[model samples]
Target: MNFVHNITAIFIFAPFLAFIILLFLSRKKLKRGAIGFSADITTFLLFLSVPVSVEALWGVNISFAVSVTAILMAMILLVLEWKKTKEIEILKYVRKTWRLYFLLLAAGYVIIWLTGLALTVISF
Candidate 1:
């Protein structure tokens, strides 16, 4: 029983741990691009955890709507920012951290899938 509790606790707190790390990095004033991208990813993970959490607690399968919505909102904001900045160098920010972005993207999807699987398993 304690092991089960521990696993659930880890699942619930993983995103929060990442969030705390992000906060610490922010205090150190790291590059905005890196922090911003990480924040987006952390947010996506946090959102992803919700439906899984619900399923874990209430035996109801739910879609990862939150993650999709967050992605859409991010796209909208990016477009808006590009319009506001009106700079052709918009892609430069992405280029600076392309590898990091790719890694984060992969990690985000992995987290979503893993969490969903864990939730389904635990719910039974």
Candidate 2:
């Protein structure tokens, strides 16, 4: 159970790790489009993990409904990012505004985390 909890913690914090990596890369002079695309992939993966965590820790007290909501939003964002990646203007804009990408990702992560934590505690 401790192992499972550790794994869940890792899954939960993975987005923050990705955000830090993206931030560091951007600071190191990576291309904007590349950074934006990377951030998109990272964020999508982060959202995808929510469902997996819920399922794997089924008996654990976590906000399953919130995880579902995050997954839905994640899918939508993934599609939008995919489409944006195909358009020159949008891709350029995304690349140039990579920091905004990080900020959005951070915001999403915090919201989902807090919502799940709150709901889980309340369930008990």
Candidate 3:
């Protein structure tokens, strides 16, 4: 059971790890896309696996409100950064695609939260 919990923890965190890699480390287009997609799928799986109980897993609580707030804040920062770095014309595209990007981030957070809860349950 510990092993399973460990594996699940890894699965839950994989997307966040990938997001960091894509956001900061990756340069190649293919690599970035692959990491992003992996993060999305892993997050989706985590959301699907959430248990019914409300508890903190690995010191992180899973809350929909928190997830939404995080996503909105992140998107705001990203948009601000994009506007600063890119031309106004390019910012339009960023604005259009921003929702999708935030949605993915939110999904990832939700998965992380759920996975944490699942691991906590498994540990007990």
Query: Model 1: per-residue lDDT, tens digit, 1-101?
Result: 99997865674547656656666777566665555655655655555565665566567655555456545655665676578787636566454344343
Please give each candidate's TM-score: 0.40, 0.41, 0.32
Winner on TM-score between 2 and 3 is 2
Q: Of the candidates numbered 1 and 3, which has the greater lDDT value?
A: 1
Worst 10 residues of 2 by lDDT: 93-102
TM-score of 2: 0.41
Global lDDT scores for all candidate models: 0.59, 0.59, 0.54
RMSD of 3: 9.1
| Candidate 3 C-alpha lDDT tens digits along 24-57 | 5544656646655445544453443332223334
| Candidate 1 deviant stretches above 4 angstroms | 1-14, 17-45, 88-124
- On the 0 to 100 scale, the lDDT of residue 4 in model 1 is 92
| By lDDT: ranked, best first | 2, 1, 3
* Window of ten residues with lowest summed lDDT in model 1: 93-102
Query: How much lDDT does candidate 1 score?
Result: 0.59
Model 2, which residues run further than 4 Å from truth? 1-13, 31-38, 56-109
RMSD of 2: 7.6
